[model samples]
Target chain A: MPDTPAIEVRGVTRLFESRKGFLFREHTRTEALRGVDLAVRSGSIYGLLGPNGAGKTTLVKILSTLLLPTSGSARVLGHDVVEDSEWLRPRIGLVLGGERGLYNRVSARDNLRYFADLYGIPGGEREARIAAVLERVDLLAAADRRVEEFSRGMKQKLHIARGILHRPEVLFLDEPTIGLDPKSARETRKLVRSLVSDGVTILLTTHYMFEAEELCPEIAVLSKGRIVAHDTVAGLRQLVGGDRTLEAEAYGFDDREVDAVRRLPGVSKVVSEEYGPRTRLTLRLRSLQTSPDDVAAALPGHSELSVRERRTSLEDVYLDLVEEEAH
Target chain B: MTTVEVPRISRSRATSASLRLSFLMFMADPQWLIPSMIAPVVFGLVAFELFRGSGPYYLTYAILGAGMMSMWGQTLYGSGWAIGQDREFGTLEPTVQSPTPYVYVVLGRVLWNVISGLIGGGIVYLVVLAAAGSPPAVPDPVGFVVLFVFVMLTLASVGILFSAAWVYTRYSGFIQNVGEFAFYVGTGCMFPVVLLPFWTNPIALIFPPTWALDALRYLAIPGYVGFGWGFWPDIAGAVATTAIYVAIASTVFKRVELHVLSKGDLSDY
Candidate 1:
């Protein structure tokens, strides 16, 4: 039991059906998720990275018991998401950050109070807990102000505060730092770290690659409703090629020149892109044996040839995996 | 693994919290009271004007009719509108995701609406009394008052059931709007169901308010002959039908919650 994953999902697929047209209705079925399998360890921050419409939110909704999966199964804390939702509801906190979730006409404190009661926070500790979360999110000063008066960042903080009001064991944060200023975003990340330190498991979906690399020890890249890649950031870098990436640029590269660069030592994979008048060849190097000079030398006779190398980043790995899946 | 102990969920506490929250929201923007009161006031005045030269008991008929109409707005419309607002605010997702069953939350809103409906009914009573220049002759004033409260409860039961439809669909508000007058006619809010086609009586009897209103009129109006059933049968029918509505509401709310979860549209407006 101690080794059991905090969250486990198996062969999950979700399809959405929509109807349009007036006189003769047209029904459209979209596969939002297709056979997604994942496991998030206890007391860890797991990042879910995806492009728009990649089913990250759909997965979160299913795990949080807000939506039933069309097929397969998800379990949180050893409970089936659908069959054991009542038991799972209290243990999980979800923050689908947006302006609409909070009551705009009421004070921030009132919003928390309403959710606190809904979460069944004991009467004796409700106010103190609400105060603590507001303080943690750095919104204590504006607790009594109407939500409509707060900035977007402040509303986001209130959303996070409401999410953690009952001190859930597992928290699902869907784009939590979106629309936030740099300082507020940093503070929110710090709060996320603290929650994990307190033994909370977090499944954070974010577009910010650096945030994911910084906070999550492991991450899953979702693409086209599938978990295209799931590994540690370093592992993902290795999966794509290696820790080093080399880029060559010129007006354009002929096939022979591109092939010549591809055959160079330590080159694992090469991706070519056209930016208007210029072509850039991005090479993933598995070894340090290949230098920038080696890449430049392979494509000789081009006066405008340029080559550069840098350590591979999570963003590079995400792009590689997502782009590969697209092709 | 971190073991999590499930928190205790109290339906009563959730209901009370929902009630308090609704009351706070209502107070924050009490402007809604204006539009809600307009229909009741207009109906009360119109009914009183028509009944002015009739018999003395016509005053009772006008008050009962208009009072029922006012309570109908508050209990049924107000309760369903709360769910519609939840959809608009995107709060329905979190509220549904909470440990407490959603029906308790709706029950809380319905309770608040019941109180407001009573107030609305009192306002109608005052408006009609002012127009008539005197109180209606109630053979049993105490029975009339008790039966009046009972009618509101019957309406509240229907309100609970109706709120489920709002959860089931985003267009429930438009549907309710289209059916508002039909509901009034079907429930005989301003006129007795007996006045409608004799065949339509069975259809009207499906609504608990019909039976409850008939009972209220039986107590307030001296020569009232409702449904050819005596006062006790009407009361019994009202109780049975109200109990049935409450039962159906609980089951329907469960189904609606599951349906929305399946549709994944709890947040859809």
Candidate 2:
């Protein structure tokens, strides 16, 4: 137990009893987290990606000591989440919902100082720490204004600043760039990378595949209260194999012909769609069993024959895993 | 994220300063200040006009009763409303997440209510005396001071307990109002407990506001027979009863807080 990882979640489960309706007597205990195990290294950027209602937020809350698991145990920095919460509090900084958690009435400076006081930092030291973090977030000029007046980008930046102000060993950033412009999003990602450089272990949950691929050394795909896959984006994408996914735009493509092509010897998976005045087809295959030529040969008298093996991306892997699990 | 090296201080200083800041923040809110300051003075005038012709004792009773009314009203409402709003706005989670104990936050609210209540009550007393053009025969100053201490401790201690109503209801403003109605009605703020029918004192005695009102009335009036008891005995009883209420309220608040944490609604505000 003493040698538990920085974050060690062991078969944690949460079952919440929710009433279906007020008039009818129906109460259902929905399992938000199944018995799941996850371990984050001491100083690594760990990304958790999932669709809505995947229990990612529930897992984050449990790790932060805000919620207790029903059956399993989680520890942070060698401290049990439930029993040693006091020792854990000072060691973790959490930005649960980005800018939404900020106090709009107070200036950024005042907000940081207030939290510092709560963390038992003295007046002078708290001021110095706030100043340093504000500069890092590039909000030193706007530090005096109330947070309500801050632009969405500025608020997001301040959110990062607040989470890092105390220099917590582990920072839980949940959707840190959900509502930022492209430029602001890029800057936020860069700042997160720098935090990783500073030895702050980051546990980030986001839907943006590109951000996770760029920032997270390791990624966990959460779906319906379970981690379907946990590995590098490359590694997970490889689970779908090295087939070059070919999407073609053509007219008058017959559905039966495409289905017949799927049954052909090299074809692995075929997805067909009808767009405005056009029919589109995407096919995946194992490169070893089926060459792009054999599948192309299967389609005859077609106006166009566009064929390429699928180069798997994180998005592709994520969608495939979720869709496969749902079925 | 960098490892911020914050300067360390003595635990005593940190706790004290946090308490002081909590008090300042509590008093700065308008909900506490406006009603607390105005209610006592307004009620004092109404009482003076209604009971002045009867005797100086009734006038003194009006002043003391109004003062106690303002104390409990401001303390409980101020702490309760502020905590409720913070909960609604999702501010309570961060507060709970902080390294400070829950006791410090409650203490801050208690102190704010006590100081503001005293200030509001003092102003009301001066204005009433000036308007009446005469002062009543004062009782023992030492006993008044003791009574004031008991009232402060009692109200401050109960601040968090009453704040539970807001916590449970998720800041339904009407619910908080309903929860505090007992303080206003049973404490003789709306009507004197002594004027109640035979069976009501037992019920009213359950609240410190009732005794707080009685103690203040005994101090401010001539021929100060306090609930048919002498001065020192009345003072002692007030202190003992207030202490008992404070202890019970604190215990209740702790249980409610634990329940809230278990439910995982600490951040639901």
List pairs with backbone clashes in candidate 2: A243-A309, A243-A310, A244-A309, A244-A310, A245-A309, A245-A310, B87-B269, B90-B269
lDDT (10s digit) by residue, model 1, range B134-234: 88888888888888889989988998999999999998889888988788889889888999989989999999999998888887777888789868899
Instruction: Point out where model 2 deviates above 4 Å.
Output: A1-4, A19-26, A252-256, A259-268, A285-296, A304-310, B1-33, B36-41, B134-137, B140-146, B190-192, B241-254
Chain B global fold similarity (TM-score) for predicted model 1 against the true chain B: 0.95
Q: Residue B256 of candidate 1: its Cα lDDT?
A: 90
Off by over 4 Å in 1: none
Interface RMSD of each: 1.2, 4.7
**Per-residue alpha-carbon lDDT of candidate 2 for residues B232-264, written as tens digits (9 for 90 to 100):** 555576667777756776676666656666667
lDDT of 1: 0.91
What TM-score number comes out for model 1? 0.97
Tens-place lDDT per residue, model 1, A73-135, is 999988999999988899999999988888888899999998888888999989999999999
Position B161, candidate 1: lDDT: 94
DockQ of each: 0.74, 0.38
- Could you estimate the TM-score for every candidate? 0.97, 0.88
